[model samples]
Target: MQTDEEIGKVAAAVPVIISRALELFLESLLKKACQVTQSRNAKTMTTSHLKQCIELEQQFDFLKDLVASVPDMQGDGEDNHVDGDKGPRRGRKPGSSGRKNGGTGSKGKDKKLSGTDSEQEDESEDTDTDGEEETPQLPPQASHPPAHFQSTPRPLSSRCRG
Candidate 1:
């Protein structure tokens, strides 16, 4: 708009037009979401419901990516599970414990794991009376983590925004 000199003055009613369009869109979405919730016998609408609503309607095709990225605010059940976990539902296939960075990120193969229940179970001489290997004691806060352990992620922040 700054460079386009031929374009006439921006109309004052443009804002109102945009507002009306957005309002109609949101109103239709909420209405359809409510219907979907009712069909699913749910008391409250959820992200899954909204996503399904968007997927069902051809007009909402553009918003599929947007809703797909949105995390479900209310985790009701199988429909609202976190991303990648589609749940062992009727149609969807069971999911696997996904490897970090697609099985290439972990340096576990190079690093020797000790007293860990890893796949390479070499019969070491460190067995107890019960024929079970003794678990290694966790390192203190000042020291490094166990050799078997990977990167230590920080704890999650509190939900309350004080």
Candidate 2:
């Protein structure tokens, strides 16, 4: 049997450790979700982006049921409210089709590649040097500690012989 103080310390440390782990998991998940959104030429992340990330990645499949399906919000003059339910609205009915806002099958006619895509295209073009020797690119340098972080070596002064 452990003392009360020992049990209390363990209990407190467990929550802190769990919270830190949760924070890290959420951070990585969101980062991947953001990448998925940007890949599809979206400025703002939507449920579809998150869904795509969850669906495509096997590691995130467990969260599929937890990610609520959100209604499409791109139509003109259509309000998102659903009979006074101030919560996330459900997506379109299982069978409706046509050029409607938020429909999975419909793509926006005005959709265009975002800046990142164009930049990536430009980079690819630059890399194609038509038979020239390609130089190996170096990985980005890791960040180093500041000069102030370095400890100076101390010299021992001559003192009375011990």
Candidate 3:
């Protein structure tokens, strides 16, 4: 069993790992985005291009820690780590339920409202306290990922955990 502080440390480290991984991931994505944007001068890379970049980046980042975590076996030649290639770990596919919104159904789809759904009803109400027009509250952290696809994971920490 782990103490709270120890668990907290591991939890904290997860984001750092994610952050470092995301930094590289975004770098590659931006490079591709720039490449596409420059080639066509379009407003942005098409959804397919962005999606490909994201998936590849996610794989790369995932592999970085994964490869490091494997134990070395002096007697086994398989223990050697090579650059750019490794056996695939069983990963949850992108958009799997575990990664889905914390019970907020898919974005933009109309959800059925029960009469008792008072909280849900109030959420849709438009509130404008300031004189400025209410910009649609962009889905919390939605724009952080390329244009509306909600599959992006939050950054985990960088430190090592048992």
* Candidate-wise lDDT, in order: 0.58, 0.53, 0.44
Listed in order, each prediction's TM-score against the native is 0.40, 0.37, 0.25
- Please name the candidate that would achieve the greatest lDDT relative to the true structure: 1
Q: After superposition, how far is residue 3 of candidate 2 from its true place, in Å?
A: 19
Q: Model 1, 1-162: lDDT tens per residue?
A: 435899767788877898999999999999998988877655556777898889899989999989888664344343434566544233212343123233321232433443354522432222222422234433322223446766667656644457
Which candidate number maximizes TM-score?
1
Give the C-alpha miss distance for residue 105 in model 2, angstroms.
44
Q: Residue pairs in steric clash, candidate 1?
A: none
Off by over 4 Å in 1: 1-8, 70-162
Models ranked on TM-score:
1, 2, 3
Those runs of model 2 whose alpha carbons end farther than 4 Å from true positions after fitting are 1-10, 68-162
The runs of at least 3 residues in candidate 3 whose Cα sits more than 4 Å from the true structure, single-residue gaps closed, are: 1-12, 51-162
Residues 1-162 of candidate 3: C-alpha lDDT, one tens digit per residue: 146564534555777798898899778767975664454433334443344344446544544443444332223223222335453233444554222334342343244422336644554542312323233333433223345556656555633444
Candidate 2 structure lDDT? 0.53
Candidate number that wins on TM-score, 1 or 2: 1
* Candidate 2, residue 91: lDDT: 37
lDDT digits (tens) for residues 88-157 of candidate 2: 3343344543222332221222123323566446434533444333344432122122255666755555
